[model samples]
Target: MKLSRDIMRFFIIPVVLLVGIIVTAAFTVFYTTTARTSSGKIISSNWPKEFTHDFSEYINIMNGTPTISDTGKNLLVKNDLWIQILDATGKEVCNYDKPSTVSDTYQPYELLNLYQYGVGQYSVFVSSVNAGDTAYSYLIGFPLSISKVVTYVDTDRYNSGKTLIIMIIILTILLILALTVFYNVVISKSYERIRESLGSIASRTYKPVAGHRFLREIYEGLDTLNHDIALADRQREKDTKAREEWLANITHDLKTPLAPIRGYAELLSETNTDIPFERSRKYGAIILKNTLYAEQLVNDLKLTYQLQSNMLPLKKETLNVTRFVKEVVIDILNAPDLEGRNVSFISNSEAATYFFDPLLFRRAVTNIVVNALAHNDTSTEVSISLDADSGVKLTIADNGNGMTPQELDDLFTRYFRGTSTEIKAEGSGLGMAIAKQIVEAHDGVICAESMQGVGTTITIVLP
Candidate 1:
């Protein structure tokens, strides 16, 4: 994993600052140590070097070689550095503006001590020279204070200020360039990656982004959003297809009853036919029955929609669940269509009261029981049982033609009829769906367990 840009910045900025400090220090040291070598002589603004070089000139004079000129002597005197030359016997042979504190006669050992200790208000240096059989010593002294060293450098190269300004400009440019490169590589590139990912998302062809710690989090979020969008698209397509299928099914169901009603009415309205009174009444009853079937189908559609939209008003009341289940089962068993069917209701508990909408609950229970009776052979047996384990539970089990796993999966979906050969042509295919909606509105769960050629069991749990 790559590091975050902010963390990299946190690490790089201090390193850059330290490097800048070191570079500035190195530059200062470089120019401060700069010297001009000329005439086999090194000249610098350093005071220590000036004192040492002045002492070296005296060695030539003490050796009788006399290399120092009068100009050099005056230069040393002008800087307040006194000079002395002593012969082999330790007698002072020459002196250049020597101070009153200086000894005229000095022993070699005594001068050596002074040079080593620098004992007086002045700092001193002593050197010895040999000329054939003769030997001589040179002594030099200057003020002991070291403050003059900085003053010397300031008076020389740094006095012009040009080098300092140029160094500052160069360092500023380098620092700016360093920061720009860091920003472009670490920060700007990450932003570019984000923009590219967004573009891919807009085109619905997004790929997961490889990124650093923080950017990785962002990429994960984008992936999640992309997944959700894809799911929503799929759901939209499924809903569209379902709506089309529902329209087709509803059209067919409506026309099935409407066609018969129209034929019978047309037959009765034919004045040319001398219809018997009994035939005319039969025709009237047929039209009324077909009309009622159509009206019920329409009402089922309206109720399903209202329940789905949470617009179905409920008249809730407290009632015994056991009694309610038994009554609903009895009513279903007494229906003309279920006249010869085997249906029974059983309950472990005699009475368990609960608050619920009796009308809606009756409809829900009726839908399930009717479904079991309608979609099975005449010999199929259905048993409705009630119990209260965790909550009020109702089980409707039938030894019917059963259903495939796929059919059971969509059994409660709107307009999804089972593939069982026993499926009725008169069904609107909304019964199970309406039942499911009603149960959920009561804050309950309903599920089915089924096996092909075995049976189907629907369990409803109410809380």
Candidate 2:
């Protein structure tokens, strides 16, 4: 509502001023356009000439004299005017209701000034009056209502200054109206497009606004906002789906181990069957293996979130980097699933030392190696190599089922599970992500390179 009020103010202020100017002009023209008589008859600008024309009918000569009829005198009386009739040589021949100030004869320029402004205290009109074959003329005068203005003028300036000013005022009004209309059209169309764009955004069907002159910066900002919102929505949807898959995978992993652990315990609890000692031991081993797998799954979940929240405790200490890494690989291969897999570890410089959380770092390495073994065919070879740069570079490369570009891109996304159908893999789908978090927590960098048909290489550079 506040924004709407501000917008209304912006538009209305200018328009209000425009309207005010028009109203003031209208009143100005209304009042200044003409005068009224004492008898309350409207005496417009054309009245003087019209009265003179109509008075001609009541005028002629009577008995070799230029005389005006009583009706003609009445016309002059109604307007409060005086009159004189002039002969061929511009000499006043007869007069009616004549004022004392007017001359009996006029020079050519005096006659011009009388017609243009009037002689001092009166305003006058002169027109030829045909009186029989004598060809005399008539003069009419009005008493000045205001001080007469004598303007410097020429042939070009001979038009009535009052009429010219009025015409100019009218033209100015029309021009202002034309321009105002044009301005309104431009603003209205831009507003319509802006409104449409906002509506589309609200409905989740947004499109970019087109370029325009008015409010172009605003349009560009909206376009940027539209792009950002679209990106954020897509990322959110992708994250949501990935999280759902992660949850499903975690549930399956928990169930996979539980089923075996429960079955073995039930078998050992049977009293009827004389279970052989070796068989019982084998059952216990299988149960322990499943329990360990389930425990590891839970640990991965706990640690990943801890890393995300910056709550993971890192007990940093100096250790034999090569031996520690090798021990991690050995422990991973010891798993029943990874036993006897073709795995190798190489290091050119084995005496390097680094400070890190050994327990958490071991978990990081195990996750990477186990992931490679669990997903690949038995014929594939895995290699773990450690090298010295400024500190250490540990790489786990595999001639196994390498991932697609999209899979590789999302490899370290916390909830992203592999899309492989080659093996029904176990564990909580967060292995790679957990590995990344642990390495990063140790102030290390981890990245991967892979080709789908050739191989996959996971590299960790630690300081």
Candidate 3:
């Protein structure tokens, strides 16, 4: 059912062959029949000329046949001539007896010497007898024994057969050549259209191919595929736009905290007093905290860039899930910002093993947990758990002011913060993007589920 190029070639050749064969057969039959009919007419036309001079001699020889002796009969039979005579009653009269080897059905009367001896050959004649009340007939036969009329007939038949074969062969070759040229011209145009569409896609011009100009179903199918590719190109462009906007927002957010820190530090350096010293120390501490926050943002951005460019090299090894979770929790708790946040671990197993890049996987999990803590209103209880279903599932559920549908739609995009959220307090939006990159690099998936006024749950399934 699949009409591939090779199959089409196979069918096309046979169709051409069948057409050639039918046409050849018809022409051959017509030619042969016409030739035979014309040859018969030519032979019949010259019959009278060959026989006119032979008839009188044949009749004179048979005059004494009724009383002929055995020796005379032998002489008559030795002449190699065929003769027959009939009586007044229209039946056979005395005549030379043919040899036993002669076939009874031989029609000597129809034979003709269309070729004479050393020039033409066999002669034929027909004679009638006039009886009182009955009519009788005589027939005579002889041969020239020299001419090549038989050879001429044989040659004509041979040439006719040859001509028929040659014409058929020539026609078949021409048909095949014509079909080849037609397919190349038509199919090549379709291929050119496909190549042009691919070039447009490579140049980032996402546009559907025009389908109306196509004449074949194959071309229509190719156009459909082109449309799908165009849709994917458009989607990628939309994602890139969203990423650029998010990155701009993150730059602004990073600059916002740095401005106050720099201003306060400049003021503190101008004087030294108890009140001034305390205020200066506070500003200095705030600057250090915000600087560390900026450093984390830069690190997340670097990781995202490496993942996007396919430059991140992973050192895969088997990791204990329970131990990995514990280490991540300890690290998060030790963070200066989350020192007073409430976190809990709920696990039924002490050992759950999975294969992944330890450094990247740790960064992914850390980002999710930190994101949950940063978004919560007050002292939030975050739960981390792992299950055994051929993978490690990390669930970081939070009791926080959750996100809306539109916010969740752009949740994992780079530097995207939810609506109704403070951009200053929400850390660099690159955390979730970096987490997504790391998870995907490890051949895993991460998803978020949230409802407004309730909470958010971030689930990571690592293989």
Candidate 4:
């Protein structure tokens, strides 16, 4: 049986009823047996004497009848009594027959009390009485049936049993109802907590209760469900912001190159015979540069997507770190846009060998240096250094208009621009985010320390 049902039936009411039944049954059986035994003993002891005295009284009332036949006739007149006269030698003297035609055989000097005879439930007693001095005795017989006593006792017991059974059933039902009501109240309170949790989650204001306790699996399950719903809600918010930033970044990057491309194309379309060849060549070169820049931006966007989606394949190689950094710095210094900027490298490690994907690692480092140059004032100097302790540490520092604490906190977020920078710049603002992603992919950490009006330092730690 279920726990609730068993508690209601057995624990609550059946205990009382079981005890009542056992006690009542014992008492009924004891009373019935005791009554029957006492009735038999009484009839055995007194019935014979009672019948003999009644016969003698009858003889006296008849004025001392002289003959045994006269005594028998007078005894027979009182049909309620059974009487027999016997001789002194235990021989039958006279037997009186009743109107029912039943024969009575008299015996002499036979001692009898109420004796049970035949298969019937009755007590029979026989007594010998001295009637005259002629050596004759009268034997009187009496019968008392215990069946009536037993019938009455049994009827009472049966009625009592029925009443007890009914009481047990009624009490059991009442207990069950009471327990059911209590259980419903308790369980409903538990369900109310669950309903409140659900309502909060539906309203997007979900908060978890601290130190909650649960007795059932359902309560624990509800707690877990609420937690998951809250987490998903936060994730949805993050995804919405990321999507908006991505669209804005893409539009800004595309527009930067498109403006110059469209301007050069319009100039080329006008049929002006006085157009100088050098100016024409310069405009054509600008168009080509912007076209390639736009193409590079599209490819970088594709690569970023592939990396995030787990579709980018890595080509690992062992490279000398010192030689790699020196070559990259020299290449950056030779760029047309970086001609006026002072770039320098300081390395303490000679033969620092590391294993990495060269293309990805180079991209990450170049993006950082490019971002520094773009943000720094023209008069400021950019410095790059490599130092090793347990592993390699790369530092890129620029003396530029630095960032505040708030800007530093959100530095690597996509499409987030520093307050001091023009929002119309060609930068997509994904560079630092991509750099951080690549650094983490190589099992490294990237951090920045900046002070307003001082400078910003970007540090990369690789292990």
Candidate 5:
């Protein structure tokens, strides 16, 4: 239901309003005028009364009526009207400086025509008066001086101008209305689409919305948001399943070793006189071994969780990577468990020193080396190589019982183990996963390559 404000609405309406006001104000200020007539200037609506009053004055002056006075003559003179009296003999008896084009007499129809057509040039006020018992027709004529302003005002052009002005006003209002509708109803639809798209995103629905180029940044940003949201959702689903699997694996792994430890302890603690000291010592050793294993599993799980949660602290120092690998290999070879193992160190770089957390780094390296030694036969050769191109590169390779592609792919997953791990009850699957996490925390990448029967190689690169 939310609507985005279109900037066009802000700009267009003010401009349209300004234009309408200007046009209307111009009409009011420039073209309007007061109306006028022959007797006096007056309002437009009283123009007919003014015209009739002027005509009556002319009639009384031309007829020489008893009510006439100098005031009547002054009225005719001021208005520039003339009067002529004609007898039945067709001779002019009275003249008030009539036009030379004026006839001495006129037929009734001809006079009517002159009244109709000559009104622009003359006002012929005809009246019948008795003089010495004979009837005389008085033709009072007013010379019309056409005012250009008045003529212009009276022309169809004037009305047309008024019509044009009105049309302009109406058109301006309609245009403003049209523009409002276009920007509001038409342009606003884009904002409505954006609103709906946002709602869909909130509800976790994916739908692509097209956007105008004018608002390209908003469109692109929303698209990126949509993509990221989908990716996070997919990752969340994966993490949920992985969490469930990790729990299951941990339960099975703990129970497997605990069962042996408990059984051995029970055997050794039994009140049986038939049990020999040799058998008791062997059972005690088995219990100790299983207890150490369970302890190791718990410690590995704790380390992995700390590393995953970014709580594992690091003590960084510059160490010679080549010498470091060599020292680790020597220690592995010296170990009582890996005494006869064929483990060695090889390097292309002489002294590849880098800053890293040694304790965590050593644990990562030890886990990989221990895994190699524990999985393969004592005759299987294991090598730790160190090299530097741009930075340090360490590789742990073994010619042990190699792994399949699937096992190699899942090697770094938490609680994931290959057939080698299940067969050899040695280390928890969390070792490789923890090692990968620790290496990555130091801004390094760890990769494993393996074949079905050849060997497995774990590579760590640090920048």
Candidate 6:
């Protein structure tokens, strides 16, 4: 399994982005929900504890003098904190910005309530200072949120549970890190297999990516690409093989007729021998026929190329459908060699006008009709039918040896002739292909149906 840089980056980038987003969101929630602004600085959940005790260092009495420094007093006013200094009797001695709600003296029970809950909405903290063995108490109050919660614990119990809590938290973090590593490993392995499968596409050797629930979409797209490429490759090979065969056939066909023409002309050109007139005439006719056969083959090749390249100009006009079809069939069957053929023409109406290029259309019709007769014996009756209902429809059907399923499928493709056919004449192997193109050029549809030994039918539908 190969894991290229691109695949690794593709997988890593998204995971990295996800982790970043989670971390950023966690910090955002912590700050936005729990943080408060104090004196141009952001203070967190412990703001109350820090604010109350931070003034203690500036509150020491010196040499029987009670003192609160200027810096400590500024901190109290800025944070809206109040300070009250009390002697041993619980009577206020000195105060700074003290609240009106606070009385001049506090009793024992009031002191307990003040220490635990503070005055009104304020939460308070206490600090002690001493000078010359005189101990003075200071109370600092801060007005903030609605709740004042303090935990009172015995020293032994607190110390005993602290180690267990630390161990539990450490184990939980370790478990989380292990699961993260395991998840990444599995994801990396899956991407490696997918990378290998993608690489196989270049060599046309595909591997199925199955049982990957998370990578279902990727695998499905790969499967479709493989299938379409395989189909296209097969079609290209088939066309190439067919084209090669047709080239071989064309060479053989052109040479076959040239041999007889050259041989007969050489015989008639002999100067020493006096040839019989009638025999010479026969040789001349033989030469002419072969020459015409070669000419027809060349013409078919030229027309096929012209149609394929869309270079053939179409001259369309309205023509009487029933009359045009009847004349075409009669003209084809009027050939001397086709004298014994049995045929019939059928039509639902006398006349209908359809617009099409007659010259190209005639070639298309002649090719289809001759195709039916050439493959069948003279005794196998043929019928030509036309209808003006809905649109124009023409059908040429014959009861002959017919064709197999494979032949029917490939009828309009470039196949020289089927193995089952008895050849009286051969074409350039592009007859049906040309006919289909002509019909399609006129924006019409041509299709064929055949059953083995039952007969064959070719249908043409025009818009």
Worst 10 residues of 4 by lDDT: 112-121
lDDT string for model 5 (317-372, tens) is: 99887787778778877888789777778788777788888889988999888888
Model 5 CA lDDT for position 392: 77
Ten contiguous residues minimizing lDDT sum, candidate 3: 110-119
TM per candidate: 0.59, 0.57, 0.54, 0.55, 0.56, 0.65
Model 2 pairs in collision: none
State the lDDT of candidate 3 residue by residue for 91-140, as single tens digits: 44645543343223323332222123211233434455443444445544
Residues 1-71 of candidate 4 have per-residue lDDT tens digits of 23445334534454466567768987786665442232244233333445555555443212333234565
Where model 5 places Cα greater than 4 Å from the true spot, the runs are 1-177, 186-188, 199-205, 209-224, 271-275, 317-320, 334-342, 349-354, 372-381, 388-391, 398-409, 419-426, 449-456
Error of 2 at 24 (Å): 22
Candidate 4 residues lying further than 4 Å off, grouped into runs, are 1-188, 207-239, 266-276, 419-424
lDDT of 2 by residue, 1-463 (tens): 2345545654676678888988897778766656666677656656666677777787778776788889888878877888898877888989987978788997778788778877666678777767567787787887645333456777555666768888998898788777766776667667767888888877788888655768989899878888888888998998898989888878888898899999999999989989999999999999999999899888878888999999977999999888898888888888786789999999877788888899888888988887887777888899999997468899999988788999998999977777444666566778899999999988899999988878899999987
Candidate closer to the true structure by lDDT (higher is better), 1 or 5: 1
Residue 173 Cα positional deviation in candidate 1, in Å, after optimal superposition: 12
lDDT of 1: 0.77
Model 5 deviation from the true structure expressed as Cα RMSD, one decimal place: 15.1
Candidate 1, position 408, lDDT: 88
As for candidate 1, its clashing pairs are: none
* lDDT at residue 282 of model 4 (Cα atoms): 95
Winner on lDDT between 4 and 6 is: 6
Candidate closest to the true structure, highest lDDT: 2
Clash pairs (backbone) in predicted model 5: none
Sort the candidates on lDDT, descending order. 2, 6, 1, 5, 4, 3
**Which is better, 2 or 6, measured by TM-score?**
6
